[model samples]
Target: MFTLSEPLASVIARLKAPAQQGQIGRLRRGIEKEGLRVDPAGRIAQTPHPHALGSKLTHPHVTTDYSEALLEYITPVYCKPHDALAFLGDLHRFSYHYLGEELIWPASMPARLNGNASVPIADYGSSNIGTMKHVYRKGLDVRYGRIMQAIAGVHYNVSLPDDLWPLLREIDPQASDTAASSDADYRSSRYFGLIRHFRRNSWLLMYLFGASPAIDRSFLDGKPAPDWLEAHGSDTLLSPYATTLRMSGLGYQNKVQEQLKICFNSLSNYVGTLRHAISTPWPPYQALGVNQGDTWQQLNANILQIENEYYSDIRPKRVTRHNETPSQALEARGVEYIEVRCLDLNPLLPLGVDAAQMYFLDTFLMWCLLSDSPWIPDDECDHLDDNRRLVVERGRDPAMRLNIGGELRSVPERGHEIFTELEAVAELLDILEEGSPHSDAVRGLAPLLDDPSLTPSGRVMARLKETQQSFAEVMLALAREQAEQFRREPMDAAHRALLDELIETSHRQQGEIEAGDEERFGAFLEGYFTRAREPRAARAV
Candidate 1:
């Protein structure tokens, strides 16, 4: 029988009490979607960023990721999921107006990359920080091929209110004891606990929502394709039972990263290990060197050029202040929120993700936070890695078995167990919201497990088969369709005005930053690395 942990059961009961039902509006969320700018021929566009969009470095809403062509849209934090998605739609509408004949590719896996030189690294202007950003991308091109960096996805950021934690601590006496620490420290510790549990159950999310089961052949970049992947045409590859090839070894895989053992058992250990990596030089990267003549190729020969290079399915995050590193910000302010990084762009949706997915995420994360999360030993961490690889590669295979607590369980059976627990959490959410959105979203997953063909990956594959089209062809069609839909729907006048103002403001901001620099680029780089190596100290309240 599936059973909830004692603390979870008690919290649920208290949350369902008559007095607390309508007070659950404290969950805040934000969304970030990355899309590649592509030409009408379905190739990644080599054109410079559109002038109307302003500077990629200073733009508040729209910015570039690794490639200048990869545009990332960020929404302001919002209490209601619908409002956040609506803001995303507005950003898209504004983008389409300036795209001319170009279009934003609608899939998580990117359009074709002809070669290394074809992908342009983003330029942020003449400031030292701006140059550092460009050099980091150059280092990525050296370490991992630019082709791998081109893959795009959606990130969902979420945080619970301060009021909810005290209630949780009251129900769990063990948590109450930790109240001796400052609220910031307590919250950071609890958020790390949440992260550990999220890692254990994250595979279930891949099974439910993973959509990138196929990709264009050119993404392979002339390398031999894996045996399990079948060619659909001269230009496309398909996987029969794959869920998210985007998360597979073929996607963001880096052989060198395997050596770094990053632990999430506590905030101190997590920060300590990452600090070591940033300082420790790697032999392979050292051979590449930091610069060739006057041109800077990378920041340093360290294992990671910066903290952002360490990619994972989810991350504990704190918003950084000006000139602060990610680690510095975390040590100072604690975990303000978490960024869920594994979601693929559901090409069928105009905003990449919809409200139903958002509701499901909230329930799933709550389950992760409230569940009994034991400390993961080294061997179990290896097992967790294996399980994630299995699901991302072949999750839809009915006979596939996963390692759950040393017991082998069929994927569907395990999925059923997870959903059963999730449904209970969904009911609690429904009681909190005075409606059934969360409950209805949980119930909707039932058909997906019973009939694999109903899953997002299944639906994508089915469409490919029925249309007799390559991945690129199908994705391009969807992109055009979505573009037309956004073009026809009237954009909010206020949002249009906001976009214009932001573009002008970003341009001025970039100019100001470039002109205000006093330190030489070399001295600035030295100072930044020096600060990164400093011991962790809590910021004064």
Candidate 2:
């Protein structure tokens, strides 16, 4: 059992702790002496550039060496040599979009999203490939803005040991972890392993969520859109997170189609609560207002319902357009982690991450996990559907509340708990990292919380407010600043030369594939898929 040992009490103590003077002063002085533009709340301002809205949007899983990375993480590498699926560039989408839901019917949707990439492509017509954005970027300020936080992602799933499968569902929860646990429930050998396995192979485990909404061209706003992509692109997205033949049966090749069908039914039971935007009066057809019949105000009455029954982390609604913006669940059959689908990368960072901030996220996720993450009870899941509407349009208002624990709690309290727990996690990371740079970095989150005016989101809001610029303007400014910094740190010379060599090798491989070198390519894909499909075999190798 891999216990999460960072004790809660010890870490919580740091919530009120102030930043160390040495680092704080140096940070302040660095900004002051350099005349760096700090926002009203004392954070560096974003600079302007061509892709100024998006600094280099290099996400982690997307940045690894393709074959080596697959070997290291997923195992097995099948598909075409230029197989975009086998590449790490695409797989990062899954890691990027760690939220607990999927983006449905993007085929006719045209959206302008500044994701975890360098430039905010002005118009991303209908392709959903590599479209998932993590709740926040990997190591940075990725938490959703105030209103969005309440819509938490959770999984109300039951698990079974390899042997207990058919009989697992009727099992008791007092025997499981969620509510009123039974003695055998927590100790059940299948519990955490199911979760760990889900977490590890999450991208591949797309259970058919529900009927995807119709694609709406009107969502495009006059932009030229591309052809529609596969509904659940993250499942097949390029990046180190992808699935190859080797990765099969770790989750794939299950002959138990009925077991999978049961999983779909379970998921459908939850999704049933959400009616389409057209059918629901709550969404109010582009008007952010109140009405009856399961309105947001009603939904907010129980924040937990929003968090558990309705919210997601990955593939959030696109900011620029509304077509295909409706919630979607692919029709499939399987059991897996819920997908969260909303996150926009802050354009001003590198790798879209930082160390100290990661502690904030770690604690936040733990809170989501430790607190009551429930399944959509048979009665409540549907009445609380229109969460994204409230978030995108009315998220910043602190007065707003949403359902949680079957009742509404102020969003601030939710934020506090998460942030507070994060500070504590920082303390633990400091201890773990010891004297490493990561230790000092972990403590830096306090400063971020103390001065929310300084975070990337905060800064963007401030800049937009101060300059009275469109979101696009704020984006350009940040992009330029990040680009300037990235440009200065050009690829190392040795790395560039090595890249040149790899390119030549790659060109030769291409020729082999072009010559229909079936034996060679087939051998490679087979070996790779087999190795990937069998994790134990790869590890043994």
Candidate 3:
């Protein structure tokens, strides 16, 4: 069995006190899940985002992601995982009423495609902010193509209790004077520490929850598959031991972003790196031109149009105010929460995620926070990425070995070591809670470490082999099944009423914003980027 580090053990011991343990109960979490809209025939839907779903630009809950067909569901923060999930379910049920004949695509990989043109970019309306949103997406289409924009996934947002910060500061002796400068600084630093540890250990999450092991051949768009991806059925390409091909090079992974070294060691470094990327021009993008006559071809010729373009498995976030950028919010205040961006949508699960998985996530995130995390050096960051790619491509392989702190360790061995620590964290979280649910969740998923077949990816591959169905065919059937189930279920009366009100209100709000816009699009665009480029410290002042 793996033993906990002295720092982790010491913190766990301190957290065992009733007062410190009570703070754990105050954790808040939310979910933002995205799914593509496909027709009954399982092809990408050509229709616009349904009108009854409310304004994609103004709706607080439902919105379009990269494409009009990619529906994103946002849940309000809830203290309990089940409450958040309940809200997400209500959102799904509410959406189905307006969906007509379209079904929410159940998988992370896109449904059948007819090249890049089939995926329509989302149009947020003519308001300056909405126009900027649309143009940024248009830039994405020019740079990466619309096909990649259709891929969907879940983003798990979470924040530790406010009361937990002081305790964390007290427990970590090496938190340093920099973190000791202010409460915001200390909390931000600690969150970055959590992010560092998370980045290092995130491969474990891929092994446990990754569900996209196969994709329909249509996703390839006539391109040949790599030698490593073997043919599954006639219409599918798969990696036998791969966990999340969605996270692999084939999906959201970008070649240009590979060169970016965003620092998670501190909030300032993080902001600096992002700002530099957005400010620096890239030749390839510059060649595309920012505009053609009156039409905006792209947002800018920079390496990134905005901070959001530089994607990562995780992000340090603070809620932005009106007309503020994400970085501005973080700098003006501090990291309010961290967003887990790497989770795949399990087609088998109606919500793409489940309660037990939520409990496990809570346990895992808490473990990351309480662990002894050191700053990752340049070489270590590259190593972390390599480990993640290895797991993404061939995680379920029994013979697979991963680099753990510079040593080669078998997947099971390293996983077990991590779980040992996770169990201790789960225990602290489960205090005052009924039935040790968090600890139970950790123990429940522990078996997947030893038994690959129990994993979502493993199960998916197994089903495909047993049924001899194409990836698209299997997912289409599952989508239909899930849609029927949602239709049969009764939505909460209170939630149903609230959604009805919001749909109407959101439409009005979108119109008001558009009508109120006085500045030209060109001027608005310039001002937005100018504010984004201003010194974050100045903005904070």
Steric clashes per prediction: 0, 69, 0
- Per-residue lDDT of 233-332 in model 1, one digit per residue for the tens? 7888988999899999878777777777664888888888788889999999999889765588889999888988897898889988877888888888
lDDT of 3 by residue, 45-127 (tens): 99999999999999999999999999999999998988998999999999999998999999999999999899989999999
Per TM-score, the best of the predicted structures is 3
Better of 1 and 3 by lDDT: 3
Q: What lDDT, from 0 to 1, does candidate 2 have?
A: 0.26
Q: Which regions of candidate 3 are displaced past 4 Å? A: 19-24, 538-541
- RMSD per candidate (Å) reads 1.5, 19.0, 1.4
Rank order by lDDT, top first? 3, 1, 2
**lDDT score at residue 317, model 2, on the 0-100 scale:** 18
Model 3, residue pairs in steric clash = none
Quote the positional error of residue 418 for candidate 1 in Å. 1.6
Model 1 Cα shift for residue 422 (angstroms): 1.5
Error of 2 at 115 (Å): 19
Can you write out model 2's per-residue Cα lDDT over 398-428, one digit (the tens) per residue?
4555454466654344444444544444453
